[model samples]
Target: MVDSTQRIRVGIGGWTFEPWRDNFFPAGLPHTQELHFASRAVTAIEVNGTYYSTQSPKSFARWRDETPDDFVFSLKANRFATNRRVLAEAGDSIQRFVESGLSELGQKLGPLVWQFAPTKQFDPVDFGAFLELLPKAVDGLALRHVLDVRHASFMVPAYLALARRYGCATVFADSDKFPSFADVTGDFVYARLMQSQPDCATGYEAETLARWADVARDWARGATPAGAPLVEPAHDSGAARDVFVYFINGAKERAPAAAQALIARLRTG
Candidate 1:
């Protein structure tokens, strides 16, 4: 059971994958019930569709109602909000995205991920200005933001510092395709593990999942796990934190298995 105010959630990128119907979803399970079933298996999910387009409030509400009470859904912001040639001009787009019924998910809403293009390099003044444009609240509800900066240039400490200053979390992405930065920048930690291989039965070997579970727990207890890449000094306040870890697109077909394996490891411990 999770303690109040402290949670370690492990989940996949999204619940609506066709591959999951064969592996994760029960045989003959209805497509409409995928979210219902996936939520019961994992504590959280990252909503990827929102990154490409805006969804109706009814859709968000349905998702919230379909999931378990403790389940959470982190949404990726639309590309227009983060992909413009001039990011600062994205204010209106961001506002529209937020006002488009995100609050309908209520407490089920997790952090909003702002993923920049891989080609987007780190520019202190420009990036700082864009971060400042992020709203702290949406429809009277507090918002938690996570920056998924893919360029290797964003590995600098200044990027993390800017994120910390805005109380935004920087994605601790685990992938060789993109730079991995494990710095903890906010009250919570968000990680995206994208190295799972299709040939592996469970996406990740048991030993790897167990190791990640250990790291998840360490993060929950406000400690930076040993061996994690760090751009800033580590510190512990002795208070537990909420940690969200997602097995994202690597061997996309195996993501659900990887997430489920990690969840089982954490629960068993």
Candidate 2:
């Protein structure tokens, strides 16, 4: 059973970007203050920008210093690593990218996410080789490896088995095209509630948040009844107390507000 004492570490995707604010101040806040203010309320954050470009060690050091020691940062591995025009050609780039990000983030780094493009198909043999290379690629990095595969064909049982062998968690995405939480497998699950509107790709509603919280509570309690597939329990009492919910569906203006409301519900429950 899930321990009751754990506190769910909740976080949002990156900081807010306001065009109006950009117009007012050409330059963004200094790295130290920017991270400090952005992380004031949230205990964790997913570093999406890292997926596109490499960050300087100085910038990462500033980020490490600005946040509280307890805060965790989940970084997306660079796109070139996950989406290769030629798998063989991507080897050097992937190694360099992971090393650079880990070196910069230091102790604050949480998980390293590999988000594969939706167009990519699942090829067991090729994927198996790739998975074999992953552990060695990021050998010294102390971070969880998460796979976010958006293709419908990639959810096969064989793929899941490979993921299990590698100790990688599959991402649970609530979207029109992707499979729901019930279809995925992993010890450490990464769930993204992409929307509330039945048809919309973005924006989550109140009902959706409540439903997710219910699932999270069940996960924390480690109470999967008979006839159910076993999900990885929340790490421990400390890690299971609360669920980590990110507001990716809401508009830039509404995400923070939505996050606030969801946090309140978790606290009250």
Candidate 3:
């Protein structure tokens, strides 16, 4: 059941971190050179800046040029698209966000993260309508979507079912601040780990990294790892799924190191 071809991309939220310079990034690493170096160290990077505002096509192209050939960039969709009162009315905003030169990233573009505010609840009729508005492709490039809904209301089976219907992945959030749930809805898995301890040098301890690596392997093999909060009982369907894991939030300064450590563990195994 294990899909050996399944890719496992371990990365941090963003490359521009002042604390990273002290350890993750080399000394005197120019702001422009940060992406150049970070891309080589991690398999992927999540573009958080795009969440705040729309960027130019030229900027996207430049980022694509800066990263390595195999590298991927997961972008957080603009807040304007998801922060509105009515979710379904965001069709125009969603279309604009997608057409805003994201195609320039080419193969380097990964999933588009639609992160809903924590206050947002799971309204099936309304939420389903919003999910329907997400385009399957932009500029002839297939788009993979990941829903990062934080409310406890999303822990319901109906939410995961809706994601499955749209072929969109529901985020596996590993955090205390938000409900930590891991359910595989689509062909791929998107996870955000936010429990890294600030005192720990590597954000997460070695044992924790090993545990996460095992979980990733299980996910790649299309089997839910034991003990993960599940919407339904876990079973092995013998179908493989691609997995993307990001070390984010909590103890933010050490996220890069945590990702690198996890990558190394996966590589050795």
Candidate 4:
């Protein structure tokens, strides 16, 4: 499911922020090298631009070549695929995105995040049909999918059951603006920490970052931490799991710092 790199990865979303250019990238670093620099500091990155449009195969190949061999990427599926009213009718959009050039990344590609609009209510039949449209592979490369459901309607047992049935991970986003939960639904864990603060140099308070690191450790060990936000009991098959933690939203400018700090903590532990 994951590249043969480290079991746990810590990173931030996108590499094109102007604020990051000033603080995260080394001074005088060419704009073209931002991804190059960011990739070395963090093990994984959430490619947000892909959510707006499908990228060409050459672009994916360049991204793979720019990053370290062990680096990984999580792509957000295009809005065209998830922003529709009828989820069952998204087959063509879904197919176009998967065949767009995902195979170019090979194993370096992690999960495809299909994020629903906050107002999109969860319909069992429609949602099941949508999940069924997600292909298991593209061009002989195995693909992993993740559901980023935002509405409270998706916080039911049935939702988790459905996601598990398709073997797709549900995003564990730490955002007050969205329904935040850490219910495990797949073999691996994916979390988007949205509480990073601009005031804190490390994005998060040291204690909070340490807590997140511990939570990630538990997830990698195939368990959920005590008192974690959950809609149902966590599922752990006893086998170790791969964990992807991205510092996103909140204090966007401090994301790189937060990600680097979390990586340090994960390394020491």
Q: Go through the candidates in order and give the clash count of each.
A: 0, 7, 0, 0
Tell me which of candidates 1 and 2 scores higher on lDDT: 1
Clashing pairs in 4: none
lDDT of each: 0.87, 0.62, 0.90, 0.91
lDDT tens readout by residue for model 3, 9-35: 899998998888898888888888999
TM-score of 4: 0.97
Task: Write model 4 residue lDDT over 97-216, tens digit each, in one string.
Answer: 999997899879989999999999999999999999999999989999999999999999999999999999999989999998989998888999998888899999999999988888
Model 1 C-alpha lDDT per residue in residues 227-255, reported as the tens digit of each score: 98877677566678889999998898888
lDDT of 2 by residue, 1-269 (tens): 64441445556678755631342223766543556765766667888988989887786777888898877788888898879744545667667776674655566777678888888888877776676666533435565677888787775677777887887777766567665443334444466656634332224566766666566555445433222233333223223323355655535445554555566667777
Flag clash pairs in model 3: none
Task: Give the candidate order by descending lDDT.
Answer: 4, 3, 1, 2
Per-candidate TM vs. native? Answer: 0.95, 0.78, 0.97, 0.97
Shift in Å, residue 156, candidate 2: 1.5
Model 1: lowest-lDDT 10 consecutive positions: 1-10
TM-score of 1: 0.95
User: Judged by TM-score relative to the true structure, which candidate is superior, 2 or 3?
Assistant: 3
In terms of lDDT, model 2 sits at: 0.62
**Once superposed on the true structure, which residue ranges of model 3 sit more than 4 Å away at CA?**
1-6
Top candidate by lDDT = 4
User: Whole-model lDDT, candidate 3?
Assistant: 0.90
Residue 110 lDDT in candidate 3: 96
Instruction: Choose 2 or 4, whichever is better by TM-score.
Output: 4
